[model samples]
Target: MTERTPFRARVHAPGAELDVQAYDFESPELIGGDDRARLDAALEAWGRQVGMLITAKTRAVVDVATAPSRIQSFGAFIASAEGPVLWATASSAGGRILYRIPLEEARYWAARMIGAAGDAAGDGAPLTSVERALARQVLTEQLAELQHATGGMFAEPVLEAFGTEPPSSVDRDAQAVVAVIGTLRRNDRRQLAAAIDAELVLQRLGAVAPHQDAAQVRTRIGGHLALAPVEIALRFDPTRVGPDTVLDLAAGDLIPLAHLADRPLVVTLDGEPVLHAAVGGNGERLACVVVSNGDLV
Candidate 1:
């Protein structure tokens, strides 16, 4: 037996210990490329909507990033339908603050900024809270306008979620960690849609040329168009007739008009009377021409 080297009892010293602490792992489901693409498109739409709501000088930007392990700081304007409720934030990286701006606040701030600018040029007084509120109402009304213009391309649930919150101020940074956690949990599919829409609208508005008048630009772009004849026919409100009468009418029965003989049949564009023309017989064809304005009688 080769003199077996006396097995040196090599007592290995224990390596330094690692500081093990509780690690909060964020959800790593990973927003997919398709999801991200959808988000981008929705955000663009939102920015455009906001831009149309506010004056040209005002601007908004939206970004998404990984939440930091430690608290960071951020700042942003908290707006509502009423006006700039406040500017608040929590800490964030790269000097940016995390924020949740209510739709009301956005509407308010946009209106206020525009109104102030108008006043500066002697066009009108600075927008009061009431005026801001009115602007918000207009914004709500224009939701339909956006949907129609976009041909329902954007989802409605998303826009609704973003605009659901009323105007109010908040200190997102005061409870920075909590805010981040809460945002992750509370921002569901609907909220995400809303956020994207808001961001897109704002971005588009901000990109408009500075020389162009915001109000005039909005007027030109936002003007309601005459729906195609087929579209108009499809949307015709039959509510004018009693439900029972409507149900009882046979295929051959002619629906009587509320108008009288010699009265010009009124043609409306988007439910608004745009033209008045008298009914005439051109051989076997019925014709019409512009006439005096009056209620259907």
Candidate 2:
């Protein structure tokens, strides 16, 4: 071995074995796919019902989208009948849930209800005395529908407070928001969006204690799951084919299934056979009635 050459020691601190900046472990809770789907359907119903109650001609279609957790600072603002960035906090089993909407959209709806030619530009100004009365009535009706739709998931959600002003103090990084994109149409087009903070929506599903409300919640969840939405796939008989055969198939080629055309189809949920149903039609629509229960596994 030759004599080793001298080396300069590292004057600065050595690089860290683990990159502290890159190490991130915080996983803020979020609703799962099933719950998200359920909420989407419920909110769509809520939007449709609001449209029917507000005006027969004006329709509002809302699409629900998931929003990631974020921090928000509340600031004072004015309220409008249609929407002036309204905020409402409701107490739930997990904690408090916050709902928000833009005032312009709310005003647009109010205008339609009153059959008035409202201004195109709604600045979210405080509604006039008459407008405020109409707006509050509509708001209460919509809120009641929302409470009914979400009754199965959330606790008895009573409207705790409502104002144009944002909360004075809130946790810096606490809110988890869900977005609702709405389209209002009455000859002219208008778009609006609202958000709801559902921090405890998913958590409360499984949080069971001996408390009165908790006990009721648990009982309700057990009964509600049967009504939960599920995909009922209609599967024909399987015909196993080799990879080479699959690769050589073309559009016109027919791969005959193992069963006859009249055979009952296998209805599956989550990839497990749940029922056997015979395929048929019911006046311009495809329909199926259960023939028997399939072996579930």
List the pairs of residues colliding in candidate 2.
Answer: 82-106, 82-107, 83-103, 83-106, 83-107, 84-103, 85-103
TM-scores for the candidates: 0.27, 0.45
- Number of clashing pairs per prediction, in order: 30, 7
Model number with the top TM-score: 2
lDDT of all predictions, in order shown? 0.35, 0.54
Best by lDDT: 2
Model 2: lDDT of residue 123: 61
